[model samples]
Target: MTVAPRIAIDAMGGDDGLPVMIEGAARALGEDPALRFLLVGDEAALAAALSARPALAAATEIRAAADVIAGSDKPSQAIRRARTSSMGLAIDAVKGGAADAAVSGGNTGALMAMAKLALRTMSGIDRPALAALLPTLGDNDLVMLDLGANTECDANNLVEFAVMGAAYARAVMGLAAPRVRLLNIGVEELKGTDEVRDAAALLRGATDLPLRFDGFIEADRLGRGEADVIVSDGFTGNIALKSVEGTARFITDLLRRAFTSSLRSKAGFVLSRPAFHMLKTHLDPNNHNGAVFLGLNGVVVKSHGGADAGGVANAIGVAAKLVRADIARRIADDLAHFRAGPRTAVAAK
Candidate 1:
């Protein structure tokens, strides 16, 4: 029998740390018997949580780590001071080969900082981008990257993002020749700032790439399934991503209120219950629980700060899938090819 990959989870990292993460770990272990978990955090609290589950007693192990990185602490200082913070300890497990991958639901900036310092980046990847899967109108989801990892990116950096995003789409999403686009203010060739223009030129010239480059896509068209992978600077990408999430929540809440307005409406809601549930699954942030810091030497999945047990479970699942797929190695191979060419710059006209 094949042994399941061991995943190290930061049990004291997120807002709902001990309860939610512990619950999620137990649930994941139950679903996959071969799965092994290295729970890193306050040993006493973790032991208390796991004590109820006798079945998981054998599959799960706890690592004692005293410090907890606060969300407000500076990333560098936190990393230095909290040698045993849940996030730091989880990364250490990966480094020590005690875990195949690490998942954490904590401060985004701190996570990135710890990951880069701990794992480093692959060759040719100047910086790693936080790539997230966003729901689209079609059956397949869209991949967006640099989601607040590096706010100020150059043209070459954007091109690198395109390459990494493409690999993620193909490997993770199982897309063949995934359609790629640059996120911009307008769809015109000459739109936004000089950086966009230069990046467009670079991508246009690189038709020999394995993936399909579909040119610029406006932020408004993101959800319309125009492209499988969208690339942009971290600042803009973060804003666009958060806006979509906020809007989805707002619309869902409005619909819920409308459906429960009166007896007639309530009857209609019951009739359409299945469809509503489907919609909820598609739009729910909990369902799309993990974001990968792509281009890193090791797999590091960042979960939502507010993630519950379901979300944490989903994150562990994502980490396992990514490790099994050998995503980091695939990315390294793709980057080697891209960088082997005559390094071309997106020149300003």
Candidate 2:
């Protein structure tokens, strides 16, 4: 019989605190009956929260953690108290084989640092990257990576990101062979920096991989679903992500103002209410809530700190999907196939 995936949760990590985290878990459990949880937090508080949700309580086991890492804490400082903190313990659960994956809505830097130290990178992976799914104009979502994990990336790192990101796309997006591209200023071969150009050359020459390398894709074409996976350095990826978010909000606010400007506009909005509702739902960040740390020995998903129950549930869902899909193993196999040689190996930092 197949075993159900167990997820460890850092209940006390996010801005909304335990209530939202527990509720999100409950929602996820309700959606996936085979899933189980290890909720890490103060025993008394967790017991109180669990008492209210009998169904979630039934599928969950409370694991006591003595401390909570503050959002403002630095990664260096947070790593020292790794054992006692809720986030640390949750990640430990994964390393210890107690859980299939770990989920947290905590300080990103601290979580990344703790996870890397505890789990380490898989063989053939130099660094673990942060990857997240973004809404696209097409029916499927785009898989973009290095969402702030490593600020800068070398050509080798970008090539690895492409491989890992494509694996992620297959697992989560259910594409057999995802189209891969580098985020470039222009689509032309000569437009990007040396690292990007080098990475492109390497990917183009890479054979026997499951993904299709489509070369460079411009930022504006991202939403058009030109590629299934987009790879870049963390600095560029983070800025581009924030820019898209800001633009989404701007368009949403502009529509709201336009609809409320006068009675005629209000009537038109009412007439087109269904279309607007679809647009709103499509643009909502909660639907695409998880930022996965790829290349780690085990799966780690980072939810937005301010995410509500729905957002948290979505993040948990992403973790569950990856676990079921066996993303890490697939990535390892692909990496071994695509970049096999003495020179491909890099010493871990």
Which candidate number would show the highest TM-score if scored against the true structure? 2
Alpha carbon lDDT of each predicted model: 0.84, 0.92
lDDT of 1 by residue, 1-349 (tens): 1148889888888897778888888777777777888989899888887788777668889999898888898887877844668889898788778888899998888888888888888877888999988888987889899899999998878888998889888877788788999999888997888787788787777755668889899998998988999999999999999999888888988998998899999999999999988988888888788998998888899989898888888888878777877888777776666655443433333
TM-score of each: 0.92, 0.95
Report, for all candidates in order, the number of backbone clashes: 0, 0
TM-score of model 2 relative to the true fold? 0.95
Off by over 4 Å in 1: 1-3, 260-263, 342-349
lDDT of 2 by residue, 1-349 (tens): 1158899999998999899999999999989989999999999999998998899999999999999999999999999978999999999999999999999999999999999999999998999999999999887999999899999899989989999999999988889999999999998899889889989888877767899999999899989988999999999999999999999999889989999999999999999999988987898898999999999999999999999999999999999999998888988999988766333433111
RMSD of model 1 against the true structure: 2.4
State in Å the error of residue 137, model 1.
Answer: 1.5
How far is each candidate from the true structure, as Cα RMSD in Å?
2.4, 2.6
Q: What lDDT score is found at residue 65 in candidate 2?
A: 98
